[model samples]
Target: MSNTKDIPFSPPWQISDLGKPDEPKVTELAAGPAVARFAKMPIVIAEDDLVSRTLMNSLMEKWGFKAVVTKDGHEAMAALRAEQGPALTILDWMMPEMDGLQVCRRIRESGKMVYVIMLTSLGAKENIVEGLHAGADDYLIKPFDKNELLARIQVGLRILELHAALSARVKELEKAVGQIDDLKLRIPL
Candidate 1:
């Protein structure tokens, strides 16, 4: 195999396209309130292929995300395990020192409420099922359309946000129940 760094990458879309008058710019679309809510949000990208990793990093950064790029599953896992780690991650199926599936399983076993997206060239039915079974929240094939990838990422962010909101609500309900129990204890029978 050739050195990943030596591999050339030509993205499906060009940065110049963003400036074209006939089409809407990514920045323009990302200026929405929803985008602002996720702006600069940290996200993990684990891809062994240099081209894919570079492309994902660029796209995530363009979309107002702070991408934490990793070359292998081990590094990805380390990033995910860090203090204040990102809640969203994109992982390629094949990688060195542990595949995406292993990382997914580890994440699940660790009981982290993370949103995982499997980005790989494996588009077969079984591969998709396997990835899902391994705890990937979403699966996207390679040579992916930037717009579609962005949409999927947005969905993951929304899901994470909802999870956070639900957790907070659960805590509030528990606190209220505890207070109610205390009140009941004080009341005369």
Candidate 2:
């Protein structure tokens, strides 16, 4: 007999009738304070599978993220290109119109600092290498563990934060250089 207290409480719809006995349950992925820190941060999800997309959206909401869900690569690209679009994106490998690799390439070519996470069933060594070369910041195979996914997302968030800080520092340094140049102009040589 299974211990009812050991199982996490999930909505009936979320619990698959044919789910494996050993399948891990989805628990609270983020701590309360951590969730508050990233609450309402938009994240784009590009997934062709309805079930997978729904699950991702649910998880994002539960973790206090604002999920901009898309069903195709084209839609994903559009969302990412929009003004004030999310810096973090989760993309599936194969989709109609444009594949995730193509999307990643486009994002890189456009010179945007978007962090892309390729979530797919392509787990081969070559596939992982190819995905990374295509400019994906991270790659995750499908049927992923919820905790692992959250950890990966947190990593992306930290990287993005660092990028933002570095960019700001660069701008400050440039302004200081400009000020020094002005001072040099005012001073006699």
Residue pair clashes in candidate 2: none
Between which residue pairs do clashes occur in model 1?
none
Q: Residue-wise lDDT of candidate 2 within 16-98, one digit each (tens)?
A: 44233243222474332333444445689999999999999999887766789999989998988873623789999999889
Q: Which regions in candidate 1 have their CA more than 4 angstroms from the true location? A: 1-32, 83-86
Task: Please write out the lDDT profile of model 1 over residues 15-114, one tens digit for every residue.
Answer: 2433433333347354344444665556889999988888888887777667889999999988888725237899999998799999999999998878
**Model 1 RMSD, rounded to 1 decimal:** 13.1
By TM-score, how accurate is candidate 2?
0.82
The 10-residue segment of model 1 with minimum total lDDT is 6-15
Quote each prediction's TM-score.
Answer: 0.82, 0.82
Q: How far is each candidate from the true structure, as Cα RMSD in Å?
A: 13.1, 13.1
Candidate 2, superposed: residue stretches over 4 Å from native: 1-27, 32-35, 83-86
Question: Against the true structure, candidate 2 has what lDDT?
Answer: 0.78
